[model samples]
Target: MALAPEPGPDWSAALSHLVLGAVSLHAAVRSAPASRGAAAGFLLQALAATCTLAPGLGTREDCPSGAWVATVIGLPLLAFDFHWVNGDRSSANLMLGAGMALAVAGEHLGPEGCSVAGQAVLLVVAVTIAIVAVFTANTYGVWGGALLGAAGLLSRLDEDGLPLRRGDACRWALAAGSWAYCRALRTQRLQWE
Candidate 1:
């Protein structure tokens, strides 16, 4: 049998991801040239979105459970964006990327596994990023990181008993975050240029 298309939210989340990617790529071009890696950064974000939404695309059916794995893909995208904004791959980028990976890894683990580990990781990363965002006043980084984390967990809200399925909440969150993030990046690029 063919795989049924994922419902509206999944597609919408995917669409948001694509829009963010496109907007970022445009910002890079508008800034100046390809040297900034803006294209690469956005491409990575798009890749993360594709991976999250289409994990089971090549399989017999798309396994919705695998969608949370999008967090893993998000780590590299975060690192890339930081590099673009900072103009170099600083140690801070590496640390933040590792934290992102850990945070997502925790999401993948449940009570049946090592749940505490994951939550701790998520907390550390989230708090650290928020603090750094404030200290440095990197609005783009703050928005992107916050939204990326939100996308990772919020996508899993598809359980029963909730007012909205996790997927739907994730869609709206991703859509809003992606727009804000892209706007921040665009503004930053314009300022730099």
Candidate 2:
């Protein structure tokens, strides 16, 4: 017997996960010192995720909107990480902002039949941004960036003629990444203070 088709996105499940992530991150940021920039970064990431999970919006147009939300949230989070690493706020913010801009451009051009290489290049750029973010930002930023990066790669895999299995794998990877980050952050806080 053939395997059954996978169900379409379950908006309710997505929304539930988004809410839990947002709330947990919000609390974590609140506990951190204001100088750490964790609060701002967490808030932005939560907003981006929530926007992406919004109901009744699943189309190419919705994707760009989601990408814009991700860009807005990701840029500053990346900058905070850079500042944490190099103590150069201005330069770090500028670089991250540029990356976000590129990500937005990729989202816009992707559905329009960009070449496979083009899509791959865009994903590489996004992953580079995430790598920088992981080192500079806190655990939350690290995990969120990783999830986003994985999602980007999985999306490219689908674009490049991979099976739907790749997309399913991407979804699971994203969920795992987010949950792991949240758990790690909580544990770190418990241990540190």
Mind giving the per-residue lDDT tens digits that candidate 2 earns over 105-177? 6655554533343344335434544565455455654665576567657755544475446544554554554
List the global CA lDDT of all models: 0.49, 0.51
Decoy 2 TM-score against native: 0.48
Worst 10 residues of 2 by lDDT: 113-122
- Clashes found in each candidate (C-alpha, N, C closer than 3 A): 3, 2
At residue 106, give the lDDT of candidate 2: 61
Best-fitting candidate, scored by TM-score: 1
Clashing residue pairs in candidate 1 are 106-118, 157-166, 158-166
- After superposition on all C-alphas, the RMSD of every candidate to the true structure, in Å, is 6.4, 7.1
All candidates: TM-score:
0.51, 0.48
